[model samples]
Every structure is written in C-alpha cells, then in structure tokens.
Target chain A: MNTFWIILTGALVAASCGFLGCFLILRRMAMLGDAISHSILPGIVIAFLLSGSRDILPMLIGAAVVGLLTVFIVQLLSQNGVKADAAIGVTFTALFSVGVVLVSLYTAQVDLDLDCVLYGEIAYVPWDTWQWGGIDMGPRAAWGIGGVFLLSLLLVGLFFKQFKLCSFDPALAAAIGIPVVFFHYLLMTLVSFTTVAAFESVGAILVVAMLVVPSATAYLLTEKLHVMLFISMGVGVLCSVFGYLLASWMDSSIAGSMTAVSGLLFLLAFLFSPRHGMVIRMLARRRMRLGTN
Target chain B: MNLLLALQDPNTQWVLMGCILLGTSSGILGCFAFLRGRSLVGDALAHAALPGVCMIFLLTGSKSIGLFLIGAGVAGLLASYSITAISRYSRIKEDTSLAIVLSVFFGIGIVLLTFIQHSASGNQSGLDKFLFGQAASLVKSDVVTIMIVASVLIGLTAILFKEFTLLSFDPGFGRGLGYPMGLLDGLLMLMLLMSVVIGLQAVGVVLVAAMLIAPAVTARYWTDKLSRMVVLSGVFGALSGVLGTLISTQQENLPTGPTIVLSATCFFVLSILFSPRRGVLARLFRFFKLRRKVLIEDVQQALYECLEEQAGSSRPGGVYLGIGSAELALKSGKSLSQVKSALAEMVRQKIVAERAKADGSSTWTFTPDGLKNSYLLVLNQRLWDLYHMNQNEYHHVHIDQSQEELAPQLTEEMLEKMLAQLEAYDLTPKLTEGTQAISRLYAREQGGLSL
Candidate 1:
C-alpha cells in the first residue's frame, strides 16, 4: 500500500513536469531544460551548505535562482554574438563544474555530497514527510513537486494563448505587440523550476528523461500543442508507474528504470506511431502498392 | 617553466601528438558538417553516446574503452539517423529533433548509470563522468584508436569534398548534375558521427560539440574561399587540442574537454576580431580608409574644377594669379600656403599648369592629362554601374522563373527555349535602360542586395 502510494506520487510528479515540458520541447528548448537541470547543482549545494538542512523551500529557491542565472547567462552570451548552442555549452558546463568543485570542497565539513545532489534518494524520500492539520501528508518531494506543478499549471493556464502565439511565431507575436522576450524568459524560468522540483524525486539526470521523452513521444503522436500536452502528461504517468514497478521487481534504481521505460516507449512510438512511425508507414506503403497491383 | 620541462617527457609528447592528430582530423571532418549547416549535430551525437556507453557497460560487464567507444559510435550513428528520419518525415524542426534525441538518450544514460551504481557491480562509480568526459585517462592504445578513426574520417572527407561541397551549396544543381546526393549526404553524416565518437575519449560529450562548430566558425571569419577555410579550421582545431591537452596535463583535475572548448572559443573570438579581409577589425579599418580617400579625392577634384573655371578666359596666367585659387583651397580644407604648394606639385605632375601672376598671385589651369584622367574615371564608374544593373536583372529573372508554377509537361527543353528568348530580348537597349533605372532606384537605398 505504501509503495503504491509512493509510486502514485512519483507518477503525479512526472505527469506535471511532462505537461509543462511539452511547451519547452515544442519550442526547441529541450536542451535548455537539460542545462537548467545541470546548472542547479550549485544552487542546491549552496542552499544545503547555508541552511545545513535539506528543507524544500531553501533548496527550491536556491536551485531556481541558479536555474534563472543559467538562462540569463546563456541569453547574455548569445546576445553578445556567441552562438546559442555554444553559449548553452559554456554556461551549463561551467556551472556544473563549479557545483562539483564546491561539493568536493565542502564535503569534509558539510553533510552534502555530489551523489546526493545528482542522483538523489527517492527511496529515502518517504521518510521525510510533513504533517498537515490532522492528516498524515506524504513525502516532502511529493509536496514540493506538487506545489511546482500547481504553480506551472496556473502560469500555463493564465498565459496559454500568449505562450501558443510566441511558441508558434515569435516574430508575428512581436509585430502584434506581444511581449516576446518576457514570455521567452517566463517559459525558461518555468522550465527551470519544473526541473528543480522534479529533481527531488527523479534526480537531475532522469529529469531530462521526463522533460524530453514524454514530449518527444507526444510529438510523434500529434500536431496540436493541446494534444501534445495531454499526451505527454499521459505518457509520463504511464512511464512512472511502469518504471517504478520494474525497478521494484528487478531491484534497480527507480530513476534508471523510468528512463529505460520511457526510451522503450519512444522506440515503440518511433516504430509504430501512426503517420510517422517507420515500420507502420513503410508497411502501409507496401499495402498500397499491393492494392494498386 | 617546469611545465615546459614536462613537455620533453615521452608521455607528455605522446599525449600532445595524439591530440594533434585527433584535432586535425576532426576539424577536417567538421567542414562537411559546417557546410551542411548542421555543425551542432556532433554535440547531439556526443550526448547520445552516453546511453550506449552505459548500456554496453551493463551488458558486457567490462570497462574497456574500446568496447565502450564502439558502443558510443553506434549510438551516435543511431542518434543521427533518428534526427534525420524525424525531421524528414514529420513537421518537427531539425533543432527540435536533435534536442529530442539528445535529452532522451542522455536520460537513458543517466537512468542506466543510476541502476549500475545500485547494482552489485562495484565498478560503476565513475561511469557518470563519462557523460561529461575525462580525457586524462587516455592511454597510448586509446590514442592509437583515435588516430586511426581520425585518419579514416579525414581521408573520407577529402575523397568526398567536391561532392559534399556541391550538395551543400546547391542540392538542386547536384541533382541536376546526376550526383547521388543521398549517398554523399549519408557518407558525410557517417564521417561526422565517427569523428564525434572518437573525440569522446579526448574531450568528452559535453565539449565535443564545440570542437565540431567552433573551429569551422572561426575559419569562416578568415576566408570566403572553401579550401582556405577548411585548412584554417583544421589548423585551429589542432592547435586547440594540443594546447588543451598540455594545459590539462599541467593542472591537476583540469578537464581536457572544457579546456579544448575554451581554447577553440578563443580562436573563434580572435578570428572574429582580427582575421584578414572579412574580420571585424579589417572591415572597420577599410571603411574608414575608403571614406578618407573619398574625401581627399573630392577636395582635389573640386580645386581642379575651380582652376578650370578661372582659366576659361584663355588668359591662364591672369586666372591663376588671383584670390580665387586661395578661396578654393580654403574651402577644400587646405591653407592658402598649402594650396600654392599643391598647385606647384600638380604642375610638376602635369595635371595642372601655373601662369604668370597679374596681381602677385599665379593662375592655374587643368592640363590635357588631367582631363583624360577624369574621363577614364567616369567611364570606369559607368561600366561598373552597367555590370551591376545587368547582374540585378539576371537575378530578378532567375527568382521570377523559380516562383512561377509550370505544368509537368513543360520540359527542360521548353524552359531552355524560353530562357533563350528572354536573353535575346534582354539584349535590346530599351530593356537595358529599364534594368538600369530599376538598379538605380535600388542603389538609392542603404541596404544589402536581398536574395
């Protein structure tokens, strides 16, 4: 029962991140999510080092700050004539390295380590639960991730029209007096927050899987943004459930299990998705040829 | 200084040599990628190698770099193939496809790494670092492997350079020429994938992307000519590799991959600022020099005209021996004394002549040589204007033809006949005058010619 609840919580978290990630993926800012995931290491490290605790608020604030910084630095470098990809490479790697160095330097005195920051401890997560009024609330990760999901949902709901306009045609949006730069930053900031929040349960590395796979799978399945978001959220939840079960059965890491399941799902989608999948489309052609004959 | 002594060591020398070979070859292969405008595909492929590396380790229970690299190469190729397939078949953009492959593959890798760490296998501790890269662990055998792969990539690039260039610049033309565009494109992608895989051991996934793009971008600032750009990019890549390796060797824990990227970026920055002809500095310098020369020539021409105006009375001595000459020189930013000196020099040069002064000031007039020189300059300018007008007309015709919808039954022969007729009509003076007027109107604006 406990494990079921835990897995449910994981799926909910994954679904929320995936829902938000669809926009990022469609906008071709998937790598930006990856960059935010890696760059938040320093923020989390500093937060832990300063607070001497693994409280959700301080960690989220710290990671969000660093994540925002990553976006800003990448934008600044690109604005100053650095190519976008190169700027991303420079910003994320340097920040990640700095984070690693800080962790290594502080490990002697501080309780924090790079492993804890990178891979995270989803298994131990259930132990860190908070109580609400009269009920036994779930783990801190579930609540933290849930809060992020709500915030993202609110933002997305409020600016759904604006986001769609900007994502499809920023030039047109700018011409029509839409605040393109502000929206661009807002999207990036949301991505950063989602990444950090998801990092609590799934780890920094698997957060990329959550951000990319569901959206990519959705892309293969649909053309519309609304459809993509729904499909991505559905795929993420399924992967979370299947991955958790597989990890539990095989005594494997939940994060790895989730990623592998997602990868397998992508492969299936690539091979069987209607209109786009390779095998089905190829077979369809063969059938057409036979019919013509 | 002690680091200099370390360079004399055989181990250090070997590492340097290895980096040189790797860098040069990767740079050469990168030309195809740069020309294709898919320079960052190498980076995506590099990241894609991670999942493959992790999976191989999990399956084989071995940490052998050779096996690991082969796995990575396969994954890179798969990533490239997926990117191509996705972009071709779907409405998803190229960058999006790349990002999709990159994140999903790396995610799989991360998952695999976490699983491996949790597994009974005790050797999975440092597996995740392979995602970023650690070039210091390279051995002589690894260097040899890299060299072999690099050489193969370079040779393939060289062999297919002409075909690749054709396809890159104009795929339609390449197709018209009956070249196997698909085969050549695949070959180029294969070579690029191989280069990215090989670079993993030296720079790692995080920085290998820079290697593919930075050197090529740097070289672009140096030349418009393809051959020169390739060679220059190769040299820059090699220099960066050697320097990065050497720097990493000297400093403890300084990653080889990041160092190489930083060094490559330095080259890119320097080329942007200082490369000859096309560089920012050179362009700025040329602009200023041209402006100054134009100013100087305008002043001299104005002064010469004043002299000619005064000499119209046939009493050249009376015209030159007056205050008019001094006023012309003052208007042209020259002092009265300087104007006199200039007139004397011009007379010696046979561009102008000085006559006896009627009121203590000498008169001047333009010589036949000066008239001839001005006439030639005007003719040259006219010829240039005509050529550009004709070029613009040709471009407009080409664009119009491309945009026109024609029936499938309208064969190439028909198109050629139509073109011939158009050319014949274009030879008429009226048509020429029309084109000239359009070009003149276009030239009135201060913008580049739009394609």
Candidate 2:
C-alpha cells in the first residue's frame, strides 16, 4: 500500500511537471523552472512562519507569489541589460538563501523539516494519510498533487493554442494580439503551483528533474507538440513506477531514485530513440562512409 | 557581546579566512563565466559535485576534506564535459543539457547520500553539510586548502586574463589568430571547476553558484572594462564574505552560507539599483533627461519651421512674431501641456519669452539670443537631413556632432561634400546660404553673432 501510494504521488507530480516541462523546454526556459523550484524555498518557509502551521493553502499562495516574483525580477534584470542566465542565477540563489536562513532562524517555531524540502519524504507518504469524517483516506500528497495536476491539465488544455503559439514564436503571438506576457506568467504560475504541490512528495530539486528530464526525453522522440506532451507524461509515469522499484531494491531516497531513473530513460532515448538517437545517427553516417568507400 | 567573543575564537577565524579566500577566487573566476554567458554552468558544476563527493567517500571510506575536494573537482569537470558533449552532439539545447546534468547528477548524489546515511558509517560522515554548507565546520586544514586553491585560481586568471577575455568576447576571432581557443576554453572551465570545488565546503553546492554569479554581475554595473570589472567583482565577493561571516556569527544557528549569499545579493541589488553606469536609477535619470532635451529640441525645430513657413510667404516683421503654445503643440505633434512645459523651460533659460495677449492667452517669441540659436539648430537639422537623404552614399562618413558645433566636426572635404549634396537637394537653410562655404559660415559665427 505504501509503495502504491508513493508511486501514485510520484506519477501525479511527474505528469503535471512533464506536461508543463514540454513548453519550458521548447521555450529554452528549462533552467528558469529549476530557478523557480529552488527560490520558492523562502516562500514555503515564510508561509510556515506566518500561518504558524503546515497549512497547504497559505504555502501555495506564498510560493505562487514568490515564483512569479522570481520571473518578474529575472525579466526586469534582463531588460535592464543583465544577461538572462546571470539574472536567473542571481535571483534564485538570493531567494533560496533567504529561505534557508529563514528556516534556520526560526527552526524552533517553524517545525518545518528542511530535509523533507530537499530530499522529500515520499517514502513516508502513505503514513501521512488525509482523514475525512472519521474515515481513513489515502496519502495527503496524492490529494494535493492530484488537485494541482487536474488544474494544470484543465488550464493547459484550455490555453493549448495560446501556449503553443507563444512558445513557437512570441513575436508572432504578440503580432496576432495574443497576450504573450500574460500566457508566460500563466505558465509560470502553473509551474509554481505544480512545484509547490509536488515538492512534499518529490522534493524541490527532484521536482526540477521531473519537470525537465521526462519532457526532454520526449522532445527527442517526436516533433509534434501533442505527441511530445503525451510521450513526456508517459515517460514520467514510467520513471515513477520503475524508480519506486529501484529505490526499494537499493533502500535509497525514492525521489532521488526516481530522478536517477528519469536520467537513465533520457540516456536511453538519447542513444536509441528512432528519430533522433545519437547512436542511430552515428550508424547512419558510418554506413554512408562505407558506401562511399 | 557574543559576536565579539565568537570572533576571538580560532574556529571562527579559520571560517572567516576560508570564506574570504573562497569569495575572492570565485568572484574573479565568475567574471569569465558571466561574460561568456555561461553563468549557470557554475550552478550545474556545483550540483554535479555531489555525486563525486559521495563516490569518493564510498571508495576511500574516509572523511578527508582533501579527498572530497578532489572528488568534487573531478566530478564538476566531468559534468561540464558531458554538458558540452550533450549539447554539441545532440539537438538538445545548452540550457536543457545544463538542467539535465544538474538535476540528474544531484539526484544521483542524493541517492548516495541517503545510502550513506543508512549505512553504519554514515553517522560519522556529516556529508550533508555540503548541501547548505556549515561554515562552522571548517578546520585549519580546510582553510589552508582553500588558500592554496584561491592563489592558484587568481594567478591563472591573471596570467591568462587576455586570452580569457578574447574567449569570452569573441572566440572565433581568437581562433582566427591561432590562439588555441579550444584549449583556453577548457582551461577556463577547469578554473571554474576548481573554484566550485573549493567553495563547496563553505557556501555549499546549492548556493555557491550565487557566489560566482552575483558578485560578477554586480561588478558589471560598475564598469565596462574587463580588468576593472574583475577587480571590482573580487572586492564585492570578499566584502560580502566578511559581512556574511560577521552577521552570521552575531546570532546562533545562522548558517554562514546563506548569509553570505544574501549579503552578495544585497551588493547585487545595490549595484543594480544605484551603480553609476548601468544602474536602473541612473539609466532612468539619463532617459528622462534625454527625453527633456529631445522635447526642448523638438519645440525649437517646430518654432523654426513655423518661422520659415511664414518667412516664405510675406517676410514677417524684421523682428520675430510670437507663436501660440497651441499652434506649437500641433506643429510638434506633442500634447499642449507638454509643449507648454517645454516652452516654460525655454522661458526659464531666457531663450524665449511669454507675452500676455488681450484674449486671456499667451504667445511665445524667441529672444534675440534664441533667434540665433534657432538658426543654428535649423541649419544643423538640414545638414543632418541632407546627410540622411544621401545616407547610402555617405554611409561611410561618420558624423558625431550635430548640434550648433556641427561645422567643425567634419573635415573640409566631407563638409563640402555634404553641403554640395544639400545644395543639390535645395534643402540648405536660407540663413546659411549654400553659395557661401561652411568654413565662412563658421568664421562669421566665430567673429560675432549678428542675426
């Protein structure tokens, strides 16, 4: 039952992250996702302190606000002639450091687990059951992650055309009167929401891994965005299940194991994917060379 | 009081020294990364150090700081190499590759970390400090190691400063000059890797990238020259280090790493908002000042054109006639209020005067000084317009000055050429007749202004 719950939590997080990750990868803002994930640390800590409890609502709101702020700051800096990557690095680290300092400063009052934020407590997910009217419900993570995943699905589905157009050619999107900046923040908000909701189970950095690796692998497999989205979600699910089994075998961090499995899948796709595999391309070049000889 | 006592402790001294050295070296090396647009590569290298540290611990079965540093260096380099290879050989973009290598290596490291924690020997390892960094853990040996690494990094950066500068700005040019650009690039990567490895013990892997990034970025706001920027970045880095150490020691349970990062961020924020050259406030000030100047110049051009239109019909009075602010606004394509404000500025400068009309309105007329200035302004505009009209032919000619001092800026040949071009278009100002040479016009203006 614990294994099932853990895998379910991982799958939900992965699916949500993977879906959004496709757009992020296409737009070349993959590191921006990583930055948002790390920077939201302060938001979580602040929410924990302000609300004086481990309530999900305040945490989500806090993280969403900070996440958007991160994007805004980066955009502001880049517009002011700072290099984009440097702006991202400066903003996120500063915010993440503040989060860490805050977590350390009020350790006694906060009672927030730092380890759980970094490495995740997915192994203990099943134990953290959500109860309703004297009835035992499943893991709270599944509920939170499920809600975020559904929201992500609905929003992305409704704005798929806008998001797709913005990702491909922002200039054209703006030319056609689509609100490029609005859709950009909307995507960032969803990413922040998914990251915060999923962080409890997969941790912060692994959330980045879930967002980037599966979508990147799918990107190699197909040229179509819809096909890419589906493949990315499928890859994310595979990572979650296989990662759970691998963690059990190694008795290691489940989130870490999941990330490792995703990396492995990416490597496999890089080497063997039918259309864009490195090994296949090399073989094709070799065959052409042989024929010429 | 506690902070004073804490400063007196030798342990605090070592941590302080270690952090300063770490900051100075990384700040210097960070300039290159920031310049090359590879700022986040430091982040990737920092995260990639984790799996290396874990593997080294597993192999050595010991907890030597020296061994961990070596392991981290090797791992960071390998990760950099893989990132380069992945992007070079595949369709995957550099950023995506960076994200992949960073998260994946970190994931592998986390797995190893948990594995080590669960092991019997894990209790003694204390490797998790590398995650957020605990500067309190630095011993004498660690400080010495950091000192050696810092010296090496600084020395190499100084020695190859020019080559690295070339690499950062234009690698193809360096390659054309037979400078072995590829080898220089790899050496730079190695230096960056060394800095990250040494910094891991102090700032940790998570926030060390900021140490490399924020100081350099802050320095960029201060100067445009490479050498000055490198020095300024190092100073900022070391300053933040000292400040972070001091502040963190003032309070209990304050980890030095995040504090250092926060201080660096403070410097970055200050630089971004207030630096003289590139600061937001400075730029905004310059922008508004330029806008005002442009607005005033536009009003002058509009008034001059209105005078020209009137002079072309029935020569207006020997003296200039007053024009209404409303007519000026329409001619200038500006709002009435904006034109009024600009005219008010002109009045303050004694270039124009507002005369009350019988109908409860006002009109502006140029002063004698203003008439001469307007004539020069109109002549400069016509000269520029003529140059632009023949821009294709005169594209190679560079004209830096276009205000009242325009005639002296160009050489005799180019000025005559431009004036000749202006005469052909019949666009030359009537005040500065095309029949007279520009040199004579300059002499007449220099002799004494008589309009």
Candidate 3:
C-alpha cells in the first residue's frame, strides 16, 4: 500500500510536469527547460540562506525568480548580439556554477546539499508529509507539484489563444497587437515554476529529461497541439510508473530508472513512430522503387 | 594576478597545444557543416555522447580514455544516423529532430550516472565534471591523444576537400557530374563525429558545439571565398582554444568550455566590425560616398535646367533660385553649407559656372558644353530605361547589323512609335546633328554603309 502511494505520488508529479512540458516542447524550448533546470539552483540556495530554513514556498519562489532571471538574461544577451544557444549556455552554466560554489561554501550551515539539488530524493518524498486541515495529506512533493499543475492548467486554459498565436507565428501576433514579449515572458515564468516544482520530486537532471523526452516523443507521433498535449502527458505518466517499477526491480535509483525509461520511449518514437519511424520509411522506399519498376 | 602567472607558466604548454590542434581540426571540418546548414549537429552529437560515456564506464568498470572515447564516437555516429533517419521519414524539422535525440540521450546518460552514483562505486561522483569538462586536469597523455586524433581528422578533411566542397556548394550539380554525394556526405558526418568525440575530453561536451559553430560563423564575416573562410575559421578556432585554455588555467575554478566560447565570441564581434569589404564600417562608408555623389548630380542637373530657361525666354533674373530650386539637394535635405559645397563640386566638374556676384552668394549657370553634357546624360538615362524594358520584355536582343542595315527594316515610322512609348515616361528625343554624326561614325566602325 505504501509503495503504491509512493509510485502514485511520483506519477502525479510527473504528469503535472509533462502537462506543461508539452507546450514547451511544441514551442521548441526543450533546451531552454534544460537550462532552467540547472539555473534554479542558486535561487534554492539563496532562499535557504535568507530564511535559515528549508521551507518549500520560499525555495520555490526563489527558484522561480532565478528561472525567470535566466530567461531574461538569455534574452538580454541574445538581443545584445549573442546567439540564442550561446546565450543559453552562458547564462545557465554560470548560474549553475555559482549555485555549486554557494552550496559548497554553506555546506555546514545550510540544510541544502548539491546532491539533493542535482538528483533529488523522489524515494524519500513520501516520508515528508504535510498536514492540511488536520487530515494527513500525502507527500509534500505531491502537494507542491499538484498545486503547480493546477496553476499551469489554469494559465494554459486562460491563455490558450495567445499561446497558440505566439507559438505558431509570433510576428503575426505582434502585428495584431497581442503583446508578444509579455506572453513570452509569462510562458518562461510558468515553465520556471513547473521546473522548480518538478525538480524537488524528480531531481534536476531527470526533470530536463522528463520535460523534453515525452513531449518530443509526442511531437513525432502527432501534428495536432491538443493531441500532442494529451499524448505527451500519457507518455510522461507511463514512464514514471514504468521507471519506478524498473528501479524497484533492479534496486536502482528511481529517477535514473524513470529517465532511462523515458529515453527508451524516445528511441522507440525515433525508430518506429508510425509515419516518422525509420523502418517504415525504409519499407516505403522499397515500395516506391518497385512501383517505379 | 595569479591567473596571469599561471598563463605564463611553461607547464601549461601542453594544454595550449591541445586546444590549438582541436580548434584547427574542428574549424576545418566545421566549414562543411556550416555550408550544409547542419552546424547544430555538433550540439546534438555532444549531448548524445553522454549516454555512451556513461555506458562505457559502467560496462568496463574502468576510466580508460580510449574505451570512453570509442563509446562517445559511437554515440555521436548513432545520433547523426538517427537525425538523418528522422528527417527522411517525417516532416519534423531538422532542429526538432536534433533536440529530440539530444534530450533523450542526455536523459539516459543522467539516469545511468545516477545509478552509478547510488551503487557502491566511489568513482562516480567526479563523473559529472565530464558534462561541462575539466580542462585543468588535462595530462600529457590526453594532449598527445588529442593531437593524434586531430591530425587524422585534418588529413581526412584535406584528402576529401574537393568532393566535400562540390557536394556542399551544389549537390545536384555534383550528382550530375557523376560524383557520389551520398559517400561524401557520409564521409563528412564521420569526420564531424570524430572531431566532436575527441574534443569531449578536453573541452567537454558542453562547449564543443560552440567550438564548431563560433569559428565558422566568425570566418563567414571575414571572407566570401570558401578556401579563405576555411583557413580563417581554423585560425579563429585555434585562437579561441589557446585563449580559453589560458584563461581557465589561470582562474582556479573556471571551466574551460565557457571561457573558450567567450573567446570565440570576441573573434566573431571583431570580424563583424573590422573585416575588409563586407564589414559594417566599409558598407557605411560606401553608403555615405554614394549619397554625396547623388547630391552633386542633382545640383548640376538643376543648374542646367535654369540655364535652359534663361536661354529660351530672356529671363536673365531666372525666377529667384535658392536651395529649394536645387531639386537633388532639396530632396536630400542637406544643410545650406552642404548644398553650396555640392554646387562648388559641379563647377569643378565643368558642368556648371558661377556668375560673378556682389555678396559672394553666387548664382549658377550652365555653360554651352554643360548644356550638351546634360542633354547627353538625359538621353543616356532614357536609353537605360529602354534597355531595362527590353531586358524584361524580350529575353534577348541581337544587334549584329549596323544602323544602315537596320534602317530600311526599321523605318522612321517604327522608330517614332518606339520613341512615343519611351516619351510616355517624359523622355523627349531631340533631332541633334551631333547624334546623326555619331550614328554615321558607329555605322562606319561596324564596316557597314551609313544610313
């Protein structure tokens, strides 16, 4: 029963991250999410330093601020004539390195460690339960991730039209007076929030994999945005469950197991996704040759 | 200060040498990728190598550089293969396909790393440094290995340079010329994969992509010729490598990859601003010169018109000419001094004359030679317009015969009709004795009788 709750908690958190990740993938900001995952560390450390405690809200807010700052800094650098990829590399790596340094400096005083920031403790998530209204709620991670998921869902619902417009043709949206830059910043902030929430449960490195792989896999499978969203969410949830199972069976880290599962899913999509699969394409070529003959 | 001392130390020579070799080889091969618009493949392949490195470490239980590099190379090749396969099979964009492969592979690598960390292995903690690279730890053996690999890469690129250029510039034409484009493309990918894999140890996977792209992009700003661009890019790459290595070696905790990227960025900025011919400063200078010439021509033409008006109607006072009367100068919106300077330039060209004035604010008039010159300029402009029309309407115009040979076939009536169409745009054809004399001279020069 306890094991079931733990896996369920992971699946819900993973699903929430995947839901937002679908839009990010569609927008071609997969690497940006990876960058954000690395950049949020300093924020977490800063929050701990200021509050002298490991509270969720302050850390989440701190990480979110850093994530937003990362995007803005990347945008500023790119606008000042740095290439986009180069800007991303410069901003995130510098922030991550700073975070590493800070953690090292404050190791004895602070509750935070670099390992927890990097790989997270998904297995230990169920142990940290929060009591709300005198009822024993599940893991603190589940609440945090679930709250973020609801918020993201509401944001997506409210701004579906704007997101679609911006994603498909930002210039056209700008011409039509849709506040393209604002929407872009908003999207980045939302992605940052989700990344921070997901980081606590899935680990930072695996969060990047989760945010990118499922959505990318769904991209190969479908052309429609709504279909992609649903499919990516499904893929994310399944990978979490299957990964937890694999980890349990193999007696390995659940985060690693989940990432490996996601990678396997991505590989399958790359090699055998119906229209875009490699083997099907080879067969199609043989048929074309036969028809020509 | 400490960093500066470290940079000058003799012990850092091997690191510098390795960076130079890596830069030269990657830059040379990167031109092919840049030309093919596959520059981002470096990033994709770098990320893709993570899983291979981790898997090799897990399997071998050893950190032999040879085995690790082999694993990384295989992964890079696999990534290249998968990207090609994805692009061939679906309508997904090349970048998107690359993103997919990059994330998945990196994810797998992370998972494997986490497992390794969790297991009872002590060596796993330091492995993440490979993600960003640790240049300070580079040993003599590693430097030698990089040089050997770089030499092989450079040799391969040199041997296949011609075929690679042909395929890169125009694959369809290369195919028509009976060249094996498939083989060339495969060979190019192989070289790129090797460069990236070998670079992973020194620069690490994080900044290897920047090495490939930054030099190529910087080289593009310096030259239009492919050979020059390749050579310049190689130089830029080597400079970036040396500078980055030096900076990182000096700074205690500074990563080499980011420093290398920063150095390459400086090269890119310098080339954009200062390269000859195509640089920003050159283009801006040319624009200013052209503007000045256009202003002078406008002033001269305006003065010529004022003189023609005075000759026709005995209007010696000529309707009070001012800066507004100078059409080109007025249109350009130059200051009064600039307009005067342009008028003075026309006088120097002998296209206008200054009438003696009491206050030194002279009125301008055209000389007889100037009137004739203006008329010829107007006629040439008309002819240019007609030539453009002919170019658009008739794909080709053959003028093999002289005026006399064409005179009978092209009657005065036909010429009148053509001139009427031309005059609709406000051009008037004058019956000048000089024009007739020139036509006769042209006919004789063509060895045909005058009309």
TM-score of each: 0.70, 0.91, 0.73
Docking quality of model 3: it rates as: acceptable
Let me know the DockQ for model 2: 0.83
Instruction: Judge candidate 1 at residue A222 and give its lDDT.
Output: 87
What is the C-alpha local distance difference test score of candidate 2?
A: 0.87
Task: Show where candidate 2 strays beyond 4 Å.
Answer: B122-125, B302-321, B324-341, B354-363, B382-451
lDDT of 2 by residue, B1-451 (tens): 8878888998888888888888999999999999999899999999999999999988988767789988998889889988988888789999999999999999999999888887758444568888877788788988898899899899999999899999999999999999999999989999999998888877888988989999999999999999999999999999898888888777777777899999999999888889897788998999999999989999988976775555455342333346788899999999999999999899888776676667999777666567678778877788777766667887676667435556777789988987887778776665432323222222122222112
Quote model 2's TM-score.
Answer: 0.91
Give candidates' CA RMSD values in order: 11.0, 4.2, 8.5
Stretches of candidate 1 above 4 Å error? A1-9, A31-121, A127-140, A200-205, A222-224, A271-293, B58-60, B122-129, B270-451
What's the DockQ for every one of the candidates? Answer: 0.25, 0.83, 0.25
Task: For candidate 2, give the docking quality class from DockQ.
Answer: high
Residues A86-170, model 1: lDDT tens digits: 5676567657756765665577655654455555556766777878896778776788888888888899899999999998888
DockQ of candidate 3? Answer: 0.25
Interface RMSD of each: 3.4, 0.8, 3.9
RMSD of 3: 8.5
Candidate 3: residue A170 lDDT (0-100): 88
What are the per-candidate TM-scores when only chain A is compared?
0.94, 0.98, 0.95
Clashing pairs in 1: A256-B111, B320-B362, B320-B363, B320-B364, B321-B361, B321-B362, B321-B363
